[model samples]
Target: MIGFMPMLSKELRELGSSLKILYIPIVFTLLTIMQPVTLKMLPTLLKDASNLPEGTIIQIPDPSVIDVMGSLLPKFGSLGSIIIILIIMGEIAGERASGVMAMVFAKPISYVGYFAAKLIAGSLLVIVSLFAGMIISSYYTEIMFDKVDWLDAMLGTLLYVPYILMTVAITLCCSAFMKSQVGAGGVAFVLYLVLTMVPQYLGSFFRKVSPSHLVDTASNVIMGVADTHIVAPLVGTLVLCSVFIAAGMLLLRRQEV
Candidate 1:
């Protein structure tokens, strides 16, 4: 953990300088807000559709506030994950390519500090962005649709944090191992897909334990239908994140850079 604080401060400073602190939250806010906005406007948009038949009777039902709030996680699960991959793909690989990592290592920083700094910085950016987006979206949904439980909204979003953290961990792990940023991104994206998709088809137990299941669990929490199986996936996702971080540190230690 030598140089952990300095490395973390450096990472945070770099994040601010790169404008990632500004744009990432803006993107998350837009993505989350779009859910309620679209739901609210669906009836009007469908009623005025140009492609519909002249006498078409569209009967779109208005979605409840719970349903609208529940929809936010899926959008984040898909597009938000991709955005994260793109943002972090080059963090290690690009730095290594430019010899920045080597230069940083020339200092007194330990591999744990270096890897943890990247992971924490990335996770902080994403989690803060998500919190901003969810809070604003919940406020907008309350105004546009109906009242929502603040406790449910915040708790649901908190439950989803581990999954997002795992994504950052996996991406950093990929970046640490690969020499090319594109290769790191591609591999991380594939691993993301596998971690999210393959478990459901494996078995019922696998589905319940998968990191992707947390998205559904979070949605259920928002909708007030959550079951007692929450701890399993939560712990499992955290363990998986630790595994990836350790893998990254190991891989990084073996490399020259």
Candidate 2:
């Protein structure tokens, strides 16, 4: 228990030093801020592009705050997730290749403690980054559009947390097995696409099990589109994270460090 604290602190410091801590959240916030502005100006932008007859009237409904906020998940599901994967995809595998893992494990650290510390630190970083983006987004959303219900945003954010953590866990799991960080990144990205996109067309049963459902569920909450039961997807995501973490631990144990 005492040893875990330093490991966690070390991981936190590593995350703090990483540029992704700044840039990734900034990307999300920028996406949020731009959504309402883009929607409001879409008619004008389209009209200018259309080069319609002179004095042509372009009519488009102003987007609701809910719509703006709801659009966030898809942007995040696509680009934001990719950025996160790229940032963390190297974490474990890169350290291993550089002999950092070998040096650390040579000491008396518990493998479980090391793994848990990494997971906790990574999860905390994701939560903080997501919150930073959401807070900035909410401010811009309210100013550019209408005030979104804070309660709805909070609920939506809670629902979305697991999916992001799951991505980190997947990358770490892949990193543990792959000798090359680039290979880990590629495998994680491919798996991410499969998990997030493939489930859409499958069926209700797949939707219930898919982590993508968590993002969709969050969007639904933000849009006031009514809630679906999230217990399955949420639990499934948690279970999947645990499994991935365990897999990484097992792979690390087998490796000659």
Which run of 10 residues does model 1 get worst, by summed lDDT? 226-235
Question: What shift in Å separates residue 244 of candidate 1 from its native position after superposition?
Answer: 0.4
lDDT of 1 by residue, 41-150 (tens): 98778777658867888787889998999999887687999999999999999999998888899999999899899999999999999999999999999999899999
> Each model's TM-score?
0.96, 0.91
Model 2 spans with C-alpha error above 4 angstroms: 48-50
On lDDT, the candidate that comes out on top is 1
Cα misplacement distance, residue 165 of candidate 2 (Å):
0.7
lDDT of 2: 0.80
Predicted candidate 2, C-alpha RMSD: 2.0
- Give the clashing residue pairs of candidate 1, or none: none
Q: Could you give me the TM-score of model 1 versus the true structure? A: 0.96
